[model samples]
Target chain A: MDAIVVSRLTKHYGAALAVSDISFSVPAGSTLGLLGGNGAGKTTTIAMLLGLLLPTSGSIRILGHDMARDRFAALARMNFSSPYVALPHRLSVTENLRVYAHLYDVPNTERRIRELADELDLHELLDRPAGELSAGQKTRVALAKSLINRPDVLLLDEPTASLDPDTGDMVRGWLERYRAATGCTFLLASHNMAEVERLCSDVLMLKRGAIVDRGTPGELLDRYQRDGLEEVFLDIARDRRPEMVP
Target chain B: MRPALRRVWGMVYRHLALYRRSWPRLLELAYWPTFQMLIWGFTASFFAQRLGNGGAAGVGVAAMGMLLSGVLLWEVALRTQMGLAVGFLEEIWSRNLGHVFVSPLRPWELVAALIVMSVLRMLGGVLPAVLLAWALYAFDLFAPGPVVVLFIANLMVMGWSVSLGVVSLILRHGAGAEALAWTVLFGLTPFSAVFYPVAVLPAYLRPVAWALPSSHVFEGMRAVIGPDAIGPDAIGPGAILWHELAWATGLNLAWLAAACLLFAGQFKAARTRGALLSIGE
Candidate 1:
């Protein structure tokens, strides 16, 4: 079964439709890129998938568990990362990690936390308050928090944002290795086309709360005659031919 | 044996971390309570003088109660609302509201943490207020021992019951509703009989005060401390014990059960409305 199965999932804020009749699925152990404009509803769809927002209509089955009615059962095996949601600012990195560790009920939490700190180059940051960290460091900490439970399904929103190029590449490399090792599914919402090209197996391009096109990175490039994912992103944003909603 | 302590330890560590960042903000939370107490201490002591309850003895009693119960109940009330207000506000400001709630931690666990921290804060706040009431106003500070301890327990129960509704209102209507909490809370005070005997309340208002947990708190506290401060003349021992204990025991049990239900319902409602994460990072 797919790791995340969404169908006719719609969300409305008053008369405005944030995500309207959207549908997609990520096969277990695969990565899917969610692309959209400033208000194309990528975040809303993600919120629904995470059970943060109840859908105005339709259904979502994530990791074989119903998100609407049985979110906790599925949430046990899932985790998410985003810079926007920060850990307590005054909390040190280790303390922040401990909160999630307890919440996730991770076995050998101290050991797991140590492993993440070493893997993410966060050893020196363990004692620093979370708000004291630089933006890039915060990104890595957020990633560590997401992985604290060693989830089977990882939902990341701009997981590598604001990192040095070297660090960003290292993060991507680590994510790839982790996915390879655990076969965990990743649903990443990102603006980094190069990162998208590097990590995502398939792309689902969204426009105004609906999918305009979806295919493998290579397929989209070949079909649009674009040199890279960035070109394809631009074309979609411009509503150009090859990715035109029609 | 070890595990429960470990869980409690973990909960303490987490709040300690949060306090590290929020210490400055918390100073802001304290400002209002301090000001509120100063006004009560200064103004109510004025009234304490005119009532013949105004002798140096009366001034001392009034000042002591203002310092003691004022700081005590106010601290309890402040801490509970702070937990709800700041906790919910923390979720909203962090933009991680979705991430935190989506994890295995239920909302009650979150609320419980806030209450636990609030309790600690209440204890911390009381120490200084008591000393100041003595140094500044020559108030008789009777040592409470176990009686004061029971009063602390009642303070938490009553404080949180009211705060749950306050927090729930904030979650549902957004922080704009926060202004209403104080106005509502203040209006409750006169009816609560926090300053005087509930019997003194008008015939109609007497029942209102009877229904309040604070009425019990003031009554209970008076029983314990009044004897030391006023000797046998202040109020009957049996009547004081019955009234105070009745409010503490009877009201706490009823309010606790009702508060738990309301808290759970608020949790479910906040989740459905996407307000849980709205309170988190």
Candidate 2:
């Protein structure tokens, strides 16, 4: 069964079309990279999937439940994380996690919080306020928050955008292991090509509220005749076709 | 706990955590109510000494007591509204609304949590003032006995109704609507007749004053403070209490229902427009 299915997903802001005629699905346990430059409707898409925003027109099915008709069921099994968003600053890390745990109706909240804290290397920071954490620490805490419910599907928007190389690599590894261990499907919206290449089995490149390209990393590299995924990204971003590029 | 209640508990805990860790936040909860109480208490004392109650029975003490009661009870309206509004504003400031909404937390559950937190916040601010009234002026807010319960509950419900309306505006317009949180209740203060009787208002404005739940509450409060407390026009305490309860319940329920519908509508609009995304940004 697919963990996510979005068809004809569209969003509008007054005269502006934020996302137009987009469709895709993530197979269970698979990772799909959502690649886009700024304002490419990546956030809009994710918001709709999470039911935080309503689509202008589209249907979203998650884990066999229609999101528009019955979103709480899907929301109960799905979680999203983004470095751009944050937990309550005055709240301690443990307090924030416990709050989400209770919202998700997770049993044994203290036990669940401890397990996530240990895994995320947050034992030392558990008592500290969330606002005082470094960028990397905040990123990890956000990731921990996303997993507090053991969601079957995880959505991440620039999950490691502000982290140092070592911490970013560590988070990527943790996510990879997490997906492998739990068979949780992932939809990652990220600008880090290396991270995407390492984690996403398939990639969908969005530009101007529409998908312009999609393929595996190897396929995209071969098709664009580029040495790296970043080069391929640049080619697409610049709107240069393969035949036009030398 | 039931799942819905658990969700509400989570929201309450989130706000409580902030209050727990920040001394300034805790201080804010009590500062205004206490300040208002002290100022009004002294003013009442001055009035009681100067006016000398006009040779009426129990009128001297009632004059003194009414001021303290007015200030403390006004807080029931202020604190409850602020409790719900401030908690929501904090979520917007922290950029945590997206996280909370994306979870299984429903809108009604969030409002329920805010109501619970508002009650706590109301007590946190008003209790200190009540104690201060007793210690300094020997004025007991509960002097009217069980009728005080009806008076307080009615004022709180009306305050909660206003709170829900302000939240709806914020959800639709973002942080720009925050000033309404403080100003909206004050807008009704003239109508509430907090320090004076509604009969004192201009003939044209009396209907508008009567329309407010707080107006009825203040009128009822005057009756309980004794007929001579609010000039010559005060009704008897027992009859006014029952009348105030019925008016307060009916009007507050209607207002609450209207506010809830407005909030729900704005919430849906915000979600569709992605207004929720731009809240903190």
Candidate 3:
């Protein structure tokens, strides 16, 4: 079974549809990049997948568990990370990690926390309150939190958006290493085209709440006749839907 | 060791961690109730002195007793209400609600955790005030015996009921409705007869006061304490205490049931509207 499956998923905020008929699947041990511009339903899709928002219609399956019916089973093995969401501000970094570690029921929590702190270079900041961390540090903490569960399916939204280029690259590298080591599937929603190109096996591009295009990075580049994913993204953003071989 | 209990304990430990590391937070837990006790204690003393010398010794002691009990007992309700609501608001302020909901934690578990924390917070705030009342005014809120326990429990549940309703509003409308956390309980105060007897209320407002379970508790308190002050029974103690307990148990339970249903509906609506994750933001 796929790590994540979403079919005909629709979310409407009253009269306005936020995510419309979006369908996709991510095979186990592969990364799928969800690309979209402002109001393009990337966050909405993530929210639905996390069961934070109920879809107006359709379904989500994570790790073969139907989210609407068996969400806790799926949630027990899945984790989400977004820089916009945060840990409790007054708690120390280690305190924050311990809470999630307990919630996820991670065995040998102390050892796991130590490993994450060492791997993320968070050992120095572990004693500092979460509110006191710089944006870059907070991003790393969020990444560590998402990994605390050692989730089978990881969903990340704009994970490195707050970091400098060096830190962003490092985070991406760490994610690559983690995925390679654990064989966890990832659904990443990001605007960084180069990052997506570097990590994703497949890309799903959303336009106005609908999946306008989807393919492998090289395939999309070849079809759009562009040298890079950035140019192709612009083409979609500008509504210049490229001709397809069908 | 069950996973569900472990998850609930994780939430409790999370809030406790916040309380542990911050002195200001700890100070806040005891400050307001202590402040209220001091103010009311002095006011009660002043009334007792003036009226004792004014040839109405019985009226003076009764007034002092009512005021002192009113202030302390009211904390049971206030702290419980604040505990549940503020505990919820903390997640929103920290932008951690998304992280919490994404976990395997169920909504009912969240409610259970909040209620447990409310009990802890209520004790933390009220106990200090209780001690201070003893040191300063020689008034033992515990003097009412085992019935005080029931009285406290009833008030806390009533507070929880109203707190849940307030939280539901905050969930639906976001931070703009946060003031309800502090204000909603106070709105019910006049009707509760916390400072005065139900008989003091205007005839038209009397029915509204009678509907409040807290009104009965305070009235029972007056009956329990009144005879000692006046040298004659104001109301029969046995009849009033049991009657008040029965009314409070029933009314507070109904309030709690309604609040839970309201909260469930509000949570569903908020999740559907995508309001849960963005509540404080």
Q: List the residue pairs that clash in candidate 2.
A: none
Could you tell me which 10 consecutive residues in candidate 3 chain B have the lowest summed lDDT? B231-240
Candidate 1 residues lying further than 4 Å off, grouped into runs, are A241-246, B1-12, B20-74, B80-84, B91-96, B130-150, B177-187, B202-207, B223-235, B241-244, B247-269, B277-281
RMSD of each: 4.2, 1.5, 2.0
Query: Which tens-of-lDDT digit does each residue in A104-171 have in candidate 1?
Result: 77779889999999899999999998889999999999999999988999998988889989999999
Candidate 2: DockQ?
0.90
Query: Count of backbone clashes for each model?
Result: 12, 0, 0
**Against the true structure, candidate 2 has what lDDT?**
0.89
The best-first sequence of candidates by lDDT reads 3, 2, 1
- Comparing 1 with 2 on lDDT, the higher-scoring candidate is 2
Residue-wise C-alpha lDDT for candidate 1, range B222-258, written one tens digit per residue: 6655534453356543234755766676887887788
Off by over 4 Å in 3: A244-246, B54-59, B228-233, B236-240
* Backbone clashes counted, model 3: 0
TM-score of chain B of each: 0.77, 0.95, 0.94
lDDT tens string, model 3, A9-106? 99999899899998899999999999989999999999999999999999999999999999999999999999999899999999899888888888
**Model 3, residue B242: displacement in angstroms?**
0.4
Computed on C-alphas against the true complex, the DockQ of each candidate is 0.44, 0.90, 0.84
Q: Tell me the tens digit of each residue's lDDT in model 2 across A1-246.
A: 788899999988888999999999889999999998898889989999999899989899999999999999999999999988889998999999999999999999999989998888899999999999998999999999999999999999999988999989988999999999999999999999999999999999999999998988889988999988889888988998988879
Share of true Cα-Cα contacts across chains kept by each model: 0.57, 0.91, 0.82
